[model samples]
Target: MKKLLMFVCLSGFAGFPSTAVAAPVVVGLADGLAGNRFPWSTTGGMRWQQVFSAAELTGFVGQNLDQIAYQTVQGATGYTISSLVISVSTSNNAPGSLSSIFANNIGSDNTVVFNQANVTVGANSSSGGFDFALPFTTPFLYTGGDLLIDVLAGGSSSAATFFRANGSAVTTERVYSSQGSPGDAGGTATSNGTLVTQLNFTAAGAPELHPGGAVLPLTFAALSCLIFSRRRRISY
Candidate 1:
């Protein structure tokens, strides 16, 4: 009877689920610095409209992407960020055009969309810039080697907001500018040799188990059955 009870206790303890703790992951062109250049959208007047930036993640595939944070500079007139689109592709080359990124399935297979209802920024004169967190409705799983982050701002207005660019510069990634309207995808060129934007994101590290879920209940049930059987045997 004592051995049976010990066995039951050991089984119950072993079946307990472990706590799942995910680690944070950040990917960007460079660390933000003071007095960084603010790159604005191209569609709005003199300022550029859409800036397409790409980066290669060092982590393995299948990591859960949680939130994306980018540095921005507010202009005289407050601007609203319309949406943020993230696409993953195997190819390292830049997409032919912004519109083509969505339509083409050649390299990009996974696309996550985040629509901004009122992601606005107030005017700020500070050169340190402001970091904005744009959380995804659902976490996206990393599938490809390269990530293309497309930020759309100035929804239906000429008012401008600027995204801070990498001052230290990066060679692996390039920034593309579109002179025409959003989704136009025409007359695109590399704006700077190594002037990529500063951005970061959080991703899940290792997976963990939990208690009181499916496994725990089954373990308790088996343990109860074993205890009951042992009790009956001892009584007889």
Candidate 2:
């Protein structure tokens, strides 16, 4: 929310001071091709989520994350991600391997930022790269700790989204599935790699209120059993 101040001469009252929002701050890998084919629709659809640690989000302590964008190395128009839903949360999980239990990954205030039945994301013609930028309906406030982004979409898709990513971005972990639907239990937890995420925030940080409960899609229920593996841990 933008701040405004007004003064009235009739009452000889001077308006209180107001503060302007700061410029947006973006953090994450900018470009790389070693990523999954799509954050969009992949065969059998997909579910994707990545957590960013507090150290990486240093400057965004009080910021309101209003938008998130994904960069694709190869993409085109006409392709659509069906049953798309993008959600965010302050995760108890960190940059390392995500929990096999889904709820263990989510912290306080799970909120859905974007949801669309079907939509086409355009390519950035000038840059020769395509970007799928989704604005949050309810901008998430980054109070502190690790930030988690959960992306899910169902249905078969022909176009390959091929989002840019880096293996060297900080310790990373993601839960993903190729055999995903809009209403699946959960995906396999991978203890490596993360999408090069782009986060946009209100400079002054929106004065957001904290909610008591979470509004998440993949709530309680353990993920399909899989072999456990060693995970990299983000320092406390």
Candidate 3:
């Protein structure tokens, strides 16, 4: 009976530890370009078109996505960033028709992890850009893949929004134009060799356990229990 009790206890204690207090891991992509100017501000007609860029997230396969950070620039009149949307997909290419890449058009394959209409980034004092962080109300599990973040400014023509530019010879970033509505279809997305944007995010989870490590704890517990049982029998 004692051996059976020991076996039950060992089985229950062999599972992965809870990650209640694990520190969040920060992941980011920097815009290597030197300029502070906003790209794609003038390309998407006067309607609401957004630039699309993605960063490959490694080591964050099973973490929970917490927040996203982005940089933007404002015009003379200043701009308000009322909405921010983020989507995730395994594919590097934009999903759906080239003309539109809205949340719905991407189909069920994509997950919109963050959606908010009241996001605000105050006006800039100069042409230089500023950075802001948007926290997710409900975090989502990051199944280890690339993240695509879309910044929208309510389709206002008076104000200009900018994403940090990457000067790399080649990039995964693409630009597309939408009618400014979440449901509206967008124009074909294109990538210019000179322009790309930066992206960053935070995730929270315990470090993954290796196979050997997982087995070590259970083995130790079973051995200790066996020793205790043998000692008790000898004393009796």
Output the number of the TM-score-best candidate: 2
Q: Candidate 1 clashing pairs? A: 41-48, 41-49, 42-48, 42-49, 43-49
Off by over 4 Å in 3: 1-31, 34-55, 73-78, 82-85, 92-109, 123-130, 150-153, 156-158, 168-171, 178-184, 193-236
The digit string of per-residue lDDT tens for model 3 on 1-236 reads 77786776666675647433333433233344432233223322222223232334565566666555445543433444344556544444432222344443342345566676644554443444334455666565666444444444343333355555444323344445443433445544543322333233334555444346657766777787778788878877
Clashing pairs in 3: 99-186, 100-186
Pitting candidate 1 against candidate 3, the one with the higher TM-score is 1
What are the TM-scores, per candidate, against the unseen true structure?
Answer: 0.53, 0.69, 0.50
Residue 90 CA error for candidate 1 (Å)?
4.3
Model 3 RMSD in angstroms: 9.3
1-236: candidate 1 lDDT, tens digit per residue: 66776687677667655544444444444544423222233343112222232344555455666555555554444655444344433444443332334233224454444555546554554664335555666565666455555444334243444555544434333333343344543323332332333333334543344354567676667778777877878897
lDDT of 2 by residue, 103-184 (tens): 6788779998888887666653357333677878888777888888887766635555566676555545677755545345
Off by over 4 Å in 1: 1-26, 30-56, 74-78, 82-106, 122-130, 152-158, 172-180, 191-236
lDDT of each: 0.46, 0.62, 0.45
Supply candidate 1's per-residue lDDT for 178.
45
